[model samples]
Target: MTASVILAPLVPVVVLWVLAGLAVAFVALALWRGLAGWWLRGLTACALLAALANPSLQEEERAPLSDIVLLVVDESSSQRLGDRAAQTAEAVAAIEAKVAGMENTELRVVRFGDGPEDAGSLAMTALAEALSEEPRARVAGAILISDGQVHDMGLVPALPAPLHLLMTGREADWDRRLVVKNAPAFAILGEEVTLTLRIEDQGAAPGAEEADLTITVDGGAPQTYRVPVGQDLDLPVVLPHGGMNVLQFATPAVEGELTERNNAAVVQMNGVRDRLRVLLVSGEPHAGERVWRNLLKSDASVDLVHFTILRPPEKQDGIPVTELSLIAFPTRELFVEKIEEFDLIIFDRYRMRGILPMSYLENVANYVSNGGTVLVAAGPEFGAVDSLWRSPLAEVLPVEPTARVIERAFVPELTDLGRRHPVTEGLEALAPEGGWGRWFRQVEVSPRAGQVVMQGADGRPLLVLDRVGEGRVAVLASDHAWLWGRGFEGGGPQLELLRRLAHWMLKEPELEEEALTATARGQALTITRRTVAEGPPGDVTVTGPDGAEVVLPMPEAGPGKFETVWQAPVVGLYRLEQGDLVRVVAVGPSAPREFEATIATGEVMAEAVAATNGGVLRVEEGAPDIRLVREGRPAAGRGWIGITPRGAYVTEDVSVAPVLPAWAWLLLAAALAVAAWLLEGRRGGRRVSGTA
Candidate 1:
């Protein structure tokens, strides 16, 4: 119970002053007229003023609110490593018990897990939010239970009390992590890309022996190399083909210590072409020569070198020598010497014109067999007696000309297999009103053992793809494709179709017949397996960096395309496999922010807590018991902790009663004046008589 004096004005203070002025005037009049009452009038005015002030005693009942203690727990991925989980659980239980026994104190526990959007533990952010919801008067102190690895320190709120930390880790904790500091997202196929990498040792000696590193591409045989410790190294790697190249780099594990799951890193580089060098050889100068030149010249990446036999040896024109404007064609310089310099060779309506000898034709076949691409855009001459099939290059071509020309208006259609091929799939948008276009002419050709991708009029082979030794070959049996560009029967995707076909023949990885791909977006792994033949669903085994294996079942995403998604439990290199196919992808950082440096240091949280007059306490010795300490006194003792007690009070009612009535005050003033006048008059008479 509490008591205090409060004043409620019964009458306005100005009115009380007016009443006192009237009383003073009456006393002065009585004294001047030989009536004595000055002292009595002053006494009456004092009593009247006191009564109008309306003084009353106020009482209140209040109980002090308990001091609040905030407990912040770190539940990030790093806390789950090794014995740290058990240690955190035990510490949390002990903290709850200690907080329960304290008098005039309450505990508020806030648990923080891995942050959304890949931010690490948001302990400081959580603490700041909790502080904003509660009153500062009731909060006495704050305690944090973490591994001392906080990501959002700038979010620390303004605290009115002391804060402390109970770190969770051993003094001898050490870790080593593989770091790929800089890596390119895309690299040209067959070209070396320099990758900057570093191997860092945390809480370990720098002079330790260098570690052995192994690098593997697409899960092939790993190439072992030795890398020195605590230094950045530039590694030159050549991309195999166009598409996603999964490269895994790992360091040898150590003995009798922390886990080695984070000792490796995986990088994915999308392969591209630095330049497309094409050699277009034409037998004679015709209208199709400009078409081939325009198509190849449209792409900025394509380096086109076109040659045409403007004058055949048999064409005898009776004219002076060197009189014609045409220059001599250099067949030997192109096909015999610098043939390897070009990535692809295109025969556009070329025949046995005798300009390229039989030896030069054999050299072109050898070029295709030695990892070079070739495309034969056949014309009516393909069925002539001098067809290319009669030359040494016939072995590399996928189809054989049947000496028959099919000239009819028919629409080009995708085969059942072509509907699933990346080159022809999803190409309906290229046609007008989403309908296939019609071709004016197509050669009659019989497909060999290779795959038939497109069928034309009368169900003849329109396009064929086959492998020749280590290279790829393709045949487009129509020279009227340019007619589509001229909007014949509603133009189609002439450029896109031609581009995809040319790129596929160059052995781009994304267009491979059999492929295994994995893409990571945040914590989800989207795995795609593409193949031509239908078989059992491939086994997708994702091996996390911690050596944990999770086998996923892949369902069909599309025709001949199988897909599955796995929510990754931790960040690291995830190995995917299906039969002989294998791929590696990085889910998150190989070393998580928490485990990046396992040593428990209070460096990050120290400044934040210090702003609130807090200190860091190592839990190795034991946590102190929390207690309420008075203000301006020591907050902690030898074995116990102290918290400041906060006293709070709220009003129940505010109504106040008047101390006196207005009529009573007026009557009392009159009575006191009359009595004082009579008494003073008698005293004056007695004094006069005594003096006489």
Candidate 2:
């Protein structure tokens, strides 16, 4: 309990001062006039003033509160490198013990890891939140144990006490990282695209002047090149095919490097064709000839070359050849000279004609065998004596004509295999309830090789796709496809089906018959396996950046797609393999923010620490001793960090009592006035006796 004097004046403070001034004036006047009772008058004035001025004594019950010390521990990915994790653990324990021994102080610990969505270390954010939970008045100081690679510096709070840092990491630590300065999202296929890259050595990399750079595309074989470190490199690359291409660039990690996580980087660039060159050869005027022509003409990217054989060499009409108004077809130039330049070659109702020699036809077959594409749209001629099946091109054709044509109306339908094939996977869903439009005729054919994706007229092969040595071949055994385009009976997916078929032939990655793909959001990895093979495609084996492998079972999500979502343990590159297929995906980044700079320093937190009058010390040197200091004084020194003692307490009960009551004061003043009167009478009586 504590007691102190507090004023409880009967009148206002200003009124009490006025009354005291008047009493002093009256005493002075009586003394100056030579009054007999002057001394008594002075005593009476003092008593009256004291009675009017009231005072009280205040007492309180108090309880002292303990000072709070905040400890923020960094558990982010960067701290896990080398011996930093061990260092952080040791520092935390030492701090806890030191605070436990300090008098009237408590410790509050806050531990944090990698921030959400690869935001890196958020030590400042964690510190601010922990400070808000406790009383600012009770907080003595805050200490952070980290590598000091803070990513959220903007969140530093206005600390009420000093802030100290126990930095983790060695001075000799160094790292080699691959940096991609510029990479385009899309590049033209078969054209050289320039990519800017740099190889950097951070921290104490001694005598590192040169390094070997390894580059790989789509998980293929790697190529090595000797490049200068600390310099920008312009690499020229040509994509082998059209679609999404994954390019991986890496440099060898040195012996003393902090981590190999940033030694490699991955870039995904989409390959697109500048222009699609197509050669369309029509045997004669046919109903479906316009369908292929119109479709190819509508696309701005397609370069269409069309020719029609209106008159065969054997046609003996009685007219001069000059007046025939017919220009000789450049078969040699198109078939022999520039065949490879064309992306796709289409034959509309075409048959083996004497115009193109057997040698030229052989060249066409050779073209398909050597990385070229051929699409056959057959008519009744396919079943005739001059059918292409009877020529040199028959080797690449997916179907063999049976010399028969069915002239009955039937709707085209997807075969069991077609339902799983990427080209025709969802075509059936676009059809009406009554199915697709009817085709009046279809040539009878048997699948000699390759997949029978579509069928009609008693399950006869209608559409078949095959892959030659390094090329692709597709056969559509009818000339009535235009019927669907014309809305003959509610047009089917004429546009979508043909588009998918064309893109598939062009080697679009999304339309591959068998493929493995992955996409990442945050640390969750979505793996998708697309195939037409029977049964489950089996579980996928995932390999992380740390070379740790995990086998995850992929459940069937669709007709031919197997998928699963697995949470990645950390950020970095991940390789997925199921059978012979391989796919690589970066979970958060090829180089996570934490590993971007592994050699830790306290420079990032220096300004904030200085503002709070705190010290920054290295954990390798030894944990500093914790001490208590007065507020507003320096709280850190060479070998010790300090917290301020805030003399904080809570008042339980307050009591206020007047020193003297108002009525008692009034009675005492009246008594003093009567005594003064009696003294003055006695002195006057004595003076009267002397005068007598």
Candidate 3:
């Protein structure tokens, strides 16, 4: 219970003040005039003023509230390293016991893990939010239990009491992190691009001069190199394939390192072609000749070189070679000399005309065998005596001509393998309601090797893809594909089909017949396996960042595609493998921000602790004793941490009453005035008698 004086004036406060001042002036004037009853007059004035100024007593009933202590525990990924988890558990248990024993105090524990999207340990943010939820006046202090590698220090709240840190980890804690300073999102294929990287050693490191670094591209065999540590490494790399390429660089973990999570890094770069050089050789003027030209010319990245054989060596026309408008075909230059410079060579209805020597044709076949690409668009001439299939180029062709041409119109369709193959996987879905447009002509051919993806009249091979040595070869059995481009019977996906075929032959990673790919949305991994083989593509083996393997069955999602989503238990790089196909995908960040700096230190929370007159204590040295201290005093000592008592309470009941009633106050004022008048009158009578 508490009591205090409160005024309830009978008149307005201004009016009361004026009456008190007049009474005091009259008393002073009587004293100056040597009145016989000056003391009595002063007493009367005091009584009257006290009566008008009514005073009341106020009493309050309060309930004592316990002081609140905030305990913010960091359980981020970095905390999982070097026995920090055990240390944190021990410190929290000790602190809880101390706070329980302290008089009039309570502890509120807040445990937080890694932030979303690799934002790292948001210890300060968690502390600020917890502070906002409780009353500031009741707060005694805040204590943080972490490795001190806080990533959100800027969010530290304005604490009303002292802030202390019970840090985890040892003084000799060390870590090695791989930092990618510079990496391009897009890089030209076959050209060297420089990537800047650095391997930093933090904390009490052994000061090794160099380390062994292993680099892997597209999950292939790794190449190890000895490189110096603590310096920027400019690694020049040439992309091996077109499309997305995943590069992994890692340094083997050392014995005494805090963790190996930051020892590796992954970079994804889209491999692009500077220019697709294509050589188009046309046997004669044909309706589909311009189809290939138009398609290649439409792309801004393609460099097309087209030529037509207007007069063959067999034609006995009396036209002079110089007088003819046709330029001589550079057979030797295209097929032998600079053949490797071209990315793709297309022979549109080309026939053997004794123009290209047998050696030149052999050179073209050798070109295909040595990592080159060739596409053949066949017509009736493919079945003739001078068909290109009869020349040395036949060695690389995937089909054999049967000297037959089907003149009947037929609708092209995807075969079972074609439906599964990347080149023609979804072409069937693009067909119009009435089916694809019909083709009036198709050369009869039997596939000797390679996968037959498309079929036409009489179930004959319409499209075939094969690999010759290190190169790729594709055969399109009809020249009427242009009909689809011309919107014949509402046109099919002519541009799409040809584009897929061309890119597939050019060795695009995404269009590979047998491939495994993985994408990450947060920690959920979406694994997709693509294959042209019959039946279901088998399950995938996923290896997590911790080297734990889990075999997940990939159910068939579509024709030739198998996919499944797996929730990852943690954030880091993950490796996926199916048969010989292997892929690496980073779930959140290759090196999570938490592990980027693992050394436990007080620098991050130094300012907050100092401002609150608190100290940073290490769990390694044992948890400190808890004590109560006054505000604006040192709240931390050598072996103990103190909390400032807020002396906060809730008022449950209040009572207010006037010291005297208004009628009693009025009667008392009148009585004091009458006494003063009587004393003055008696004194005046005595003076008169003395004078007489």
Candidate 4:
């Protein structure tokens, strides 16, 4: 209960003061005139003046409100480390019990977990918001139960009372983590790029002086290298053939209080070709010579080296050999020595020639078998007696041309299998008006162990693609692709088709027969499997960094592509496998930052708590009993926690009664004057008689 006074004046004080002054003046005048019984007149005047002024007393009632205590609990990822989780559970129970026993007090418990973006702990932010929703007068104090790792300290509210912290975790905790300082999103294929990385130690590291850093590419054998702690190193790595190159860099596990899941980092670099080296060998200079040169030279990234055999070995000019304009073709230098240097070998309208000996042809076949690409652009000469089928290169070529030439205008059409293949799919642009430019000539071909992608008129094979050992080969039976480029009978996407065929034969990973691919956007990963078979979709098994397996149901996305989406729970390397395909990718941070010392030190919140006259009390030491303490007194007892009461009040107005009315005061004064006169007259008469 509480009490206070309020006032409303029924009579003005200024008017009463004037009336009293007049009464005093009249009494003084009587005394100056030596009037009989002057003391009696003054007494009568003073009694009249006292009746005008008004005064009163007011009383109020109040009941004390309950004090509010804010309880902030931390539930971030860091709190799950070691015995910290257990410690947090025990402390929460003690706090609940202690707050329950206090009188005229209420508790507001708030729990904060990891932020949505995994920014950091959100304990302070949640507490601030909770505080704003409560009454300030009732908040006696605030208590935080966390590991002292707060990411949103700027959101700490202006507390009305003291704030206390009960930190989690113990001393002597340590961790070691891998750190990637620099990485690029893309790298040129077959080029060495340098990546900067380092290993960092925090809290307490192992006793070993140095640690071994191992690096692996595409899950190959890891190469171990010794690296010093806390120092960055530039690692020169050569990217493999094509597509997304997954590189895993890790350091050996160190004995520590932290988990090893953060001890490794995964980086992906998209491989790109800066320039394609293509070798074009021609048996003789013909009308179709410009077609091959123009197509290869049109692309900025294609490095073309063309050699034409203008003069035959049997031809003997009458003039001296020096007089002839033709120079001897460097068959040995191009075909035998540096054949592997070129990515693709194009034989445009080339027949078996004596210029390239049988030995050189054998070397070309060996090159194709060892992961080199070859494209044979056949002409009428493909049906001649000197066809390449009689040479050593016949084993890798996809088609064997019969000694027959079909001369007729025919439109090219995609085969049944080619309709779904990536190389030939979505090729309506090649025949926008329902048909491509007609070819006047095409050689009859019989495909061996290869796929016939295109057929000419009369259902004869015109284009064939095949896998030759570790490499790829393509054969275009018609030499009239140039006629399309010349815009004969309505031109089509002749260049686009040719470009896709060349790129596919070079073994672009996206065009592979069987592939497993995973793409990450935010925290969700999309896994895809592409194959050339018809069956039930396979199951994609994903292994997270913590060795937890999640089987995702793959559904057919298209004719040959199967896809599934998986939401990643944590940020680290994720391994995916379906059938023979395997892929690994990193999510979130490349490596965990070593910002938290992990030792659970009070240094972060000790100063702030002390400013409010609060002391640190570990719940493990036992719950301190709650006690009500008087204001301006010490807030702690031997085995109790003290809370100070805050007294608050609101004001109200009350009416006051006047002491007396003007008419009443006037009547009393008249009566008093008459009595004083009578008394004086009697006294005077009595005195006169005595004197006589």
Error of 2 at 536 (Å): 4.3
User: In lDDT terms, which candidate is top?
Assistant: 3
Instruction: Write model 1 residue lDDT over 122-225, tens digit each, in one string.
Output: 88898988898788888888888887888888787877787777777776667667788889999988788999888777764334658888898866789998
**RMSD in Å for model 2:** 7.0
By lDDT, highest first, what's the ranking? 3, 2, 1, 4
Candidate 2 has its poorest 10 consecutive residues by lDDT at 683-692
Q: Which runs in model 2 stand beyond 4 Å of their true positions?
A: 1-62, 281-301, 304-336, 351-362, 384-392, 486-488, 520-527, 535-555, 563-588, 627-634, 654-692
* Candidate 2 lDDT over residue span 1-692, tens digit each: 88888876668889989988888898788777766666677777776677666777799998999999999999998898999989998999999999999889999999999898779999988998999899899999999999889999999999989999999998888888999999999999889999999999988888678999999887779999999999999999898767778888999878988899899888888899999999999999988888888888999999999998999878888878789787889999999999999999988888777988988889999999998999999999999999988889998998888999999999898998898899999898999777898999999998889998899899999999999999999999999988989988887988788888888888888999999999888888999999998889999999997899999999998878889999999777788999999887877778888887788888999999999889999999999999888878888999899998887788999999876787877777677777777877877722332343
Which candidate would rank higher by TM-score, 1 or 2?
Answer: 1
C-alpha RMSD for every candidate: 5.9, 7.0, 5.1, 9.5
**Which is the better candidate, 1 or 4, if ranked by TM-score?**
1
151: Cα error in model 3, Å: 1.3
lDDT tens digits by residue: candidate 3, 499-617: 99888878888899898988889888899999888888788999987899999999999999999999999877778988878888877778878878889999988888899999898
**Per-model tally of clashing residue pairs:** 4, 0, 0, 1
Backbone clashes in model 1: 4
lDDT of 4 by residue, 203-263 (tens): 6555455679989887778899888887788888788867888899988777654767567
Model 3 lDDT, full chain set = 0.89
